[model samples]
Target chain A: MIFAEQLTKSYRTKTEEVKALLSVDLNIPKGEMFGVIGPDGAGKTSLFRILTTLLLADSGTAVINGLDVVKDYAKIRQQIGYMPGRFSLYQDLTVEENLQFFATIFNTTIEENYSLIKDIYEQIAPFKDRRAGQLSGGMKQKLALSCALIHRPEVLFLDEPTTGVDAVSRKEFWQMLQKLKSDGLTILVSTPYMDEAEQCDRIALIQEGKILMNNTPENVKASFSDPLFAIRSNKMYQLLHDLRDDHLVQAAHIFGEDIHISSEVINQQVIIDALQAKGHTQIQLKQINPSIEDVFIKLLMHTESHEQHS
Target chain B: MNNIANNQREVVISATNLTKQFGDFIATNAISFEVYKGEIFGFLGANGAGKTTAMKMLCGLSTPSRGSATVAGFDVSTESEKIKKNIGYMSQKFSLYEDLTVTENIRFYAGIYGLSIPVIKEKTAALLQQLNMESQKNVLVKALPLGWKQKLAFSIAIIHDPAVVFLDEPTGGVDPITRREFWEMIYSAANRGTTAFVTTHYMDEAEYCNRISIMVDGKIEALGTPSDLKKEFNSATMDDVFLKLARNAKRIGD
Candidate 1:
């Protein structure tokens, strides 16, 4: 359970000012998997830093589980576990050593919370003797996560937890997160990966220091307000280039070997005829469902249009 | 012409029954693959997949317990020094000095690669301008944001213009926008005839590679264009393909 009222953060340099987060209001429900999705420099990290009490917001208020982030910083820090985007554990320490050290810092022992982190801890248990620096990217990831959950904080904040891990590790990590969620922990995760956004109970699409949209994954996807289709042909490259030039096509971009087009008209026959006239054959067109990434792109386009109109 | 054929024929690195062992445990089994000139190859797997071990052998950072590998036209076991000079490597956790200024870090890397001062300065300016970080040239690396640091680390890795560059999760922790931008930088390097060997956790990012190899249980289970791999696995998406392969791997072990 987290609530923020007009949260804002700005970093002032000697010559210029960088607004890391603009006036933003967000509410994360208790025991929910809430995702903060954005690209680089989109204030995802800044928001996490603020909520974790490592960085202070210039204005507004934020409270986690009835404790104010600014006023009750110490208590908030003790109640939530945070794994930063980067590997911030002691590199010189071994995997077990780092876990032990973090547990000690929280006035707990690994044995005390072994049940909480046993799934992740077992993966790295074989290499517990290896230095953190010597472990692979994915191993370090598991070690970091185990350390974060060692204290079994009520609230968990994972910043890009799967960023540098391999696909298997990434998938495994998400499954672990889901298990943790079932345990009734209020989890907040920030990620740049769009696919990961779908796994969350709800997500906040952030960009340029602003919250663009906040809703459940299905609801956010259903909000896409345009007719979409996937088109492919023997001449996919040329077809994509030509499709973008068509006046009827609102937005056209190459997605893999096919061209995903959003248009004003929903009729599939008209599009097929248009491509046939362009000398394209073996053409397959289907009204396809939009992914979260597609919706986000559309939202971005809509924002651009609204800005232009204003 | 002849140049194109010669280029295609040239294998910058090749592995033949390569294996790595730590005592009785085999980190890498007898595996074989070839990397072509100027190709962006994705070396991928779950944790403990032996991707890093394979990379180390190719980079001449570690010796193989058995089998052989030729890196940058040199035998990995015999001519490791030559391979080191001809290749550039950026680890998952980049090795840039936090205390050093952006310019200073570039210079330090250039110096390690035996680059001349004038050449380093010219390249540094061009690189900074390309990355739009010229204004932050004097800023300490510790003061820079994560994205900028990733970009700068990549730039420094190729400062010497090594024929091959190995990037281990170069865009890790970066937001999607920055990841796309970083890939553009990587594309530019590839376009310049620099072969890129990369590894990543994000399945979407793997779609950008020219070719990808999915390793499982110390062996390559699938290798092809991302689309080809997806099709071969009868999966609609790369993530689905990865899951199928991982599940297959587990079933085999069981």
Candidate 2:
């Protein structure tokens, strides 16, 4: 439903011209939940703005639902629900008023699209008269999302929707998106959480305005080229230092209970031998599959070093 | 770890029947816990689980409505100033001054902590070199990348060499590599006998802590090491443990 070819955007700072998006391309089919996973300042907001027709790119063309972004900006704005990363709602207005306001602007009434936002709106119904600013973080989020869906747009673009949310609420928010997707709505969301990336049908790992890898989550994890292993012992803290100190080990990071290490030639015996020599007892080592987080870290390191050299 | 020697180690922070009541609403309901010296303690809860209320009491930012607590041997109820002096605080929201140069920020913080001019100068140089940001020492903090800014904020948080440090989501929204690097920095500081009290949403980070307390509905639902919590909840990872405890929470802290 959304397609962009060679999309580019840049911003002029006092001392530099920062490229926010560079030759970026994306193709999201209808009814697919596409995720743009990246850290803060990774140009997620820029890409979202371009797709939602809120901002124009420096060059290149973008099409949404078969309409060119620049030419059909008005229609795109009417048909897409965009939730900004920063909460942007009428703070002084009550929760009910905000939803009514959004619906009114889109030339629809809340009752006209009641079924679309019913599941989400019902949670905050008791607080209908509460001011948007007075609601707690989670309540405000639910209200904002309810307003976004009040218009029942064909496509939904949420930028960093789960950035600062707690764990349980984060899960709930994703489930809501899944329901919307099942209703045949094309969804585009961005977040810094790696685990949330798996919830998407496919994800584009964006960093520094470039999509480093674009594919299914499984494919992204499977694309990890390094030999990965998980190691843990009694001296967990010292073990990290010992593993990182090894010249052969490329990266050693803590992943849950064990330390995941990547290297060129990773032998379970060699790692155990090295840790044992460092007085790390109860050493457990296992050849492990790379998670999406591991793949992203590896890709990030590659790009970072490449930039340094250039 | 403190879990194994629970009764023997020095308790850096002790909250005994601590409660905070706002009219009829109980933000914190008689929560009790102990953080041992040199241990990395993970404080976690849902949005309105009273985690912040409990943390504010521990940090001496808010007076408790009932019970008592002591941070670094200073009574939080009466010796709040002393407690603040003995502990360092850093939150991702209100971090280093963006308008200030890196050197100026570090020097200003150290000076506030009562460090002499010579000590501040020496520590500033060493910190810049260790972070490999000597070239950017004079640059505005806002000009630096997010990763560098986070790392610098963390280093400066512990500049006073306080007895314990409080970190509130220090690694939020940063890249994975930088997040790991931040953890390594935490591990290094803890190794030097400086205790760390951290609050984070990342379950993998919860695993790195020496002990964790999962709060639910104005009370601590579970408190133990990562492995013990997993076993008690019959879960595999810390994420599962957190979900099992926090899923039932109904209250949201403001």
Candidate 3:
């Protein structure tokens, strides 16, 4: 339901230019939950702003629900529900009041679309009297979603909805997204959290204004062709430091309790000795399938090396 | 780093029933923990679980309504100013000035911490070289990417070499690679005997901590090493442990 081609945007400072999007292209089918996964300053928000018609792109074409973004900006805005990175709720108003305000602005009433947001909105009905600012992070997010849905938009765009929220809350927010998607609404969510990429039907890994890879999470992980190992010992930091210095270790990164590594030494025993050859005990090593994060890290390094050479 | 990891470690921060109340609400309730010197301590909680409230009490920014705490060998309540002098604090909300150059930001922070002219000069040069950002020393902080800015902010936060450093979501939106590099920086600082009290939402980061405390409903519900907690909760990952504990929380904070 959303399509874009060669979308480009750049900001000129006093002495330099910041390229926010570089020939970006995307095609998200109807009812598909697409995730744009990238870190900060990776053009996630810039692309969202362009597609949402909140800001203009310097070049390229974007169509939302078959409507051109630039020419049909007003229609696109009316047909899309957007929750920016920051909570854009009315702090002084109560939760119900905020929903009413959004509905009023869209020329619709909350009652007119109560069926669309009932499942999500009812969760926050207990705090309907509380001010939007007084609610907790999770509650505020729910209220924001309710307000965004009050107008019954065709598609939803959530940008880092769970950025600073705790682990449980982050999971809960993603669950809400899944429920929304099951209702046949097209969803485009952007987040820096790579783990959340698995929750979407398809994901586009973006970095430094370019799309690194666009595919299913399974396909993305399956595409990784390497002997990856999860290694750990008593001295994790020391082991990491030691491994980085070893000539055999190509890349090593701390992943939770284990260090995810891709090295020349495929044998587990030889690799253990290569980790400084001593001082680290209780060693654990296991060959594992690549996670989405592992694949993204590899893609990022490739992009960095390519940029350096160019 | 190995020799310093021995058991005879110093206590940099200690708390006994540290609590903060605002009117009828108990923001932080009787949270207790101890941070050893040169150890990375992760402070974790669900939204509204009182992590920020406890941190403010520990940093001497807010007075606790009950219980007590000590940071950097100084009592938090009675020696508020002294505690402020001996600890470095950085949060994602406010950091180095975006309009200032990298070196200029470093120099300004050093001056604020009461460093001398020559000391600031020497530290500025060393910091730039250490960060491998000598070429970008003159570039405005805004010109730097989020990862670079976070790294520079971290360096400046510890420029005074405080007894302990508090990092609040320091790597929130940073890429995975840069996030690991940031943790490496924390490890190096801990190696240098600077205790790091880090707060993060990433479960993987919680695993990196020597020990972490998971707060729930204004109280520290779980506190131990990553492995111990995972074992105690009978979970495979710190993320599962966090979900189990925080799932029962009564408060949902920002």
Using DockQ as the measure, the top candidate is: 3
lDDT of each: 0.81, 0.87, 0.87
- True-contact fraction in model 1 equals 0.33
Residues B1-254 of candidate 1: C-alpha lDDT, one tens digit per residue? 00022333568778999999988767788989887776778887776778779899999899999999997789989999999999888864856999999999999999999989899889999988877887889998988877778888888888888889999877755644455457666766776767888876457667767778888888888898887887898998888888787655541211
**Model 1: clashing residue pairs?**
none
**Candidate 2 - chain A - TM:** 0.96
Error in Å for residue A231 of model 1: 6.6
Off by over 4 Å in 2: A305-310, B1-8
How close is candidate 3 at the interface, in terms of C-alpha RMSD after superposing the true interface residues?
3.3
Which residue window of length 10 is worst by lDDT in model 2 chain A?
A: A301-310
Q: Per-residue lDDT tens digits of candidate 2, residues A1-310? A: 9999999999999999999999999999999999999988889999999988889999999999999999999888888898999999999999999999999999999999999999998888998998899987777778888888888889999998877788887878889999999999999999998988999999999988999999999999999988898877887788887887775488887775677888888777877887788787787788889999999988887786434621
The candidates' DockQ values read 0.23, 0.55, 0.56
Query: Residues B1-254, candidate 3, lDDT per residue (tens digit)?
Result: 12136668789999999989999999998888899998889999887788888999889999989999999989999999998888888877789999999988998989999999999999998998888898999998988878888888999999999999999988888887788778788888888889999887778678778888988888888898888898999998788999998878766465
Please give fnat for model 3.
0.62
Q: What tens-digit string does per-residue lDDT give for candidate 2 at B214-240? A: 888888889988888988999977888
